[model samples]
Target: MDKKKISILNLAWILILTASLSFSGCRTDMQEASKTEEIFGTIVSVKAYGENAEEAVFAALEKAKELEKIFSLTISDSEINYVNQNAFKDAVKVSDEMFYLVCRADYFSRLSGGAFDYTIERLIDLWGIGNDWARVPKISEIEPLVGLHDYKNIVIDSQNHEIKFKTDTAMLNFGAIAKGYIADEMKSEILKHGVKSALLNLGGNVLAIGKKPDGSLWKIGIANPFNPSSNIAFVEVADCSVVTSGNYEKYFEEDGVRYHHILNPETGFPSKSGLAGTTVISPVSADCDALSTATFILGVEKSVKLIESLDGVEAIFISENGDITYTSGISKYHFKELN
Candidate 1:
């Protein structure tokens, strides 16, 4: 092995070197190393097609941690959390990145007609819908909290980078948009480091930044909402984002009814819309991710209109009963079946 080749810090480059060594008829025990990943409670597997892909994966993980630190509501000092925590106590100025995100959240809240809101955290915790043990909150308990979560009330002073809530009870949570942004940011940073291709499969939110090693399009799978483990369809594309928002994920059952995490801002409860899931494919995975949640909250009719208005974005809607609906663009890239 070339000592200089080993010094390449990018994992994608490293993997290529490994493969070339194998193809060149050289014998070396498969290089092995383990690095703990800090995002989503799972150690992300790093693979390389060229060289230094291990370093790229580790770098991605590092980037994910930085995002986590900035966005975590659990942390008292994170700008978003700090603003929410300090609301009605004292005004706190935020960083420009934090300021922009707060502004973006506000804009999306308005764009989606308040369907996409960050202040739904109180209701989320009350129902425990995202957690393993789910509990139902009484209407009495939720009614008061729902009144507090008006996204229009999130006042952003862009010039000063300060944000404040109109109501004392309102708090912020970035469950919908944070992961997609992290993936998108990681992709940009990875590319800047000279990697031409990288695939990030964050649970089901998949983004392919570059072409495959064979110079073909990247093939990504869309998980069936009906069955979490299996995919209902596959999409072949390069440099696109495929994000799914489903009623099946993060849900709980009580008696005979099932409750899921995606909530209606109006009612502060699981949206009763008939759609099962919605996938939005765009150049921006982060936007697709956030809009998927927003579109689901908007229901089928409104979501269809939203997708149509956006350029270069395609969509697929999966109904609660497994009816598949496709926009013009996604129809072209659809995979017929799996072997």
Candidate 2:
């Protein structure tokens, strides 16, 4: 991918960069370095504060780019494409990282009862939402792909680190959760260089490490699904990841109907779960990223119940009418909705 400006219609989280750096007590003498690049199909930027900030941020971004080569669906030689092409004929051996992430994605698939299916790639291909040739498919075409969300059909061999598909037609897509894992890995890479404080914006998945140079929480604005250029709310957080998912970001319109990219594996269409957007907050970006997409498909009530059951995971759901609902863990002290 090529580095470009973040389009309002494509990102659901906006880092209030200037506001975050404006804390009164921030240390003025700390060294800082930042860089932005296009990777994982989104604008990824990293900023770090420390003596090694420059080297660390660059290394972290390089790590992200390297990971993308192994995971991206569109990359012709990626492990994902190799599996999709040949896993049905034989168990495909993969790297340890690939196996682990596949397992994590499988766990989320089971937890959401298939709402977070990674095997929904067939449907994603059919819709082709972000592609130039995107279109609405007939019910007949969508029917066969719906059952592909049966994630159990994806067989994993722990001993051999292989991935196999019981069904010939099934394909895997990690568009929802891979970025989170990548973000976490990038943070680890930064820490390895002795950087204590940093901020990352991978697409719209914002992860704050430690705190701002001023010892204040990072400010992240939740994009308004109805108005992508503005924020409906903002959160102050430290050492956490804030990820948002919505039907607004990627979509195609036909005959006055807008079809978004968050396809419901059950329906093989854009989710009609009555939620316009969902934002997940957690210390792990992978969980936040996975939960954001899954909960958006689960709708408000089920999402609320499910989030409450999980430890350290909180969610904010925005209704189709622009009303907001959140989990018990969220309070005005750290999270606030704008008028």
Candidate 3:
């Protein structure tokens, strides 16, 4: 063969190889994998679409279980249980992850003016709304526990990674934000495995990682407080978290009076802020989770103002009268009202 003919043949072979590689890449990118597990007191699911989707989802689920062990108050040997049991007597050293979450919880506690409290475990136990024992307590029984709902009682030493309580009666519970925190951690784990698109639904708290495989935003539904079976609205989001706190979840009726789990730390009873539910959207899942509860307690006007003041935070407040009020930023996300 001539030299020119030989060079042309080599170029053709190179093109064929390149096309084969590109086609293989596309096939891997379209693959999807998902896994669901009951952990952290809720059903957590992780889904990913890409070459490493299965491994990423599995790893994320494992991470969620690890976090549950560290944060679960009911777990006998968990770090949180240790702190709750011994923090009052002596400063209990906690894991770095636990210390960071406690600090963040305290920050939000102060930010929401005690509306979102971590030191309300005593109050939660008294009401037992979502616990094995669910019932309404007498006024005298709830009144004493009211004073124990103070977040100020928590003493955190970031330098030493220790936590202590000022009062022996005080307890710590991350039930409000644990799922969100675990979801955020799982997102990190999924991305580390080279998953560019994923969705994590920790119970009702949803976090979308990057965009969908089709390059479209993820649509998350906001549950209707009055009718838990239906959605009141939907928000399109990407690389963000949508969290809702409502009276409809974990509530029981006694003598025609319904008592919910989202209690006011100040009152030791379910909040009566004239709001049915609050949904918050933010880049941080934990922040969205805490703010959802805070905004629900803050009511419509205050919650709207608070969300507006914070950068990259948006909220939807559904009133007891079935009216919806949302922040300006959420409008661009194409929020649709169903009812």
Candidate 4:
């Protein structure tokens, strides 16, 4: 062979090798790190993708623990406990995080017209819901607790970072929104660590950060209200949170009646609005969490109206008759019904 032909052949082979290497480097196949731990009375799973995935997942888990300490009502020395214990006596100073959460809780309470209230601890304790000794309280026992769950009585001073209660009977419980709050905070932490794609599943409250490694949306399943173990539908989402509030999650059956943990602040009993479950999808997990509960309590028509007025929020409501209704915004996404 001639020298010119040999040189040209060698150069072409080198170019092909270099191009292959460059293309492989830009491929979407990335490493994923996942961890699951029990936090906030539920299992929280964090999955991160990228070089710092492991570190990001662990950092998110730590953040969840830190927030749990601040929001847990039963924790002895927790910030919420201090506020609850000092109710009616004097204003109790709280951390900035606690104060901010309380403000958000109050806002949602007013937004739902007392449908989703944080100051329902008195009623919660009366019903013993989510407790080891959960039982069905008598009507006489529950009568006095009515009107005591008012969120208006609870005061929040953002300037001093303090919280006060008009009546000592006023107690705060963040069960409906705490997980969502933690998920948001974890997402922030993960992003700070340069993890672009992740999934935070705080029990049933799922938040998808960015798209999948392949750049596709995340598919989240909506649990079947009638069959707790199965899913009724799937919601494809990205960069958003999906949360559901259902009557079948925690409950005790007595005298052929099923009593769920989601109690109405007004009735001081399980809310019965013909809805078996309600799911909210939004950019903010905390907002989704609060709205899910409120929607379940408000029923289908009112919930749809409330979601339609809000921007960047969507909902799926499952009625007791197994009918499913979704907001207009959700029409953009694909929904696959399993049942």
lDDT for every model? 0.74, 0.91, 0.89, 0.90
Q: Which residue pairs overlap in candidate 2's backbone?
A: 26-214
Best by lDDT: 2
Model 3: lDDT equals: 0.89
User: Sorted on lDDT, highest at the top, how do the candidates line up?
Assistant: 2, 4, 3, 1
> What TM-score would candidate 2 get against the native?
0.90
Give Cα distance to truth, residue 62, candidate 2, Å: 0.8
lDDT of 4 by residue, 52-164 (tens): 99999999999999998999876788878888888669988888788878889999999999999998887888888778788898899888777664689887777788788
Deviation from native of the Cα of residue 258 in model 1, angstroms: 1.4
Clashes (N, CA, C under 3 Å) per candidate = 16, 1, 0, 0
Task: Report how far residue 152 has shifted in candidate 1, in Å.
Answer: 0.7
Instruction: Name the weakest run of 10 consecutive residues (lDDT summed) in model 4.
Output: 330-339
* Residue 20 lDDT, candidate 1, scale 0-100: 93
TM-score on alpha carbons, each prediction: 0.84, 0.90, 0.90, 0.90
TM-score of 3: 0.90
Deviating ranges (above 4 Å) for candidate 3: 1-29, 147-149
lDDT of 3 at 198: 96
Report the C-alpha lDDT of model 3 over 119-193, residue by residue, as the tens digit: 888778888887768898899888877745568888888788888899876888888888889989999999999
Greater-TM-score candidate between 1 and 3: 3
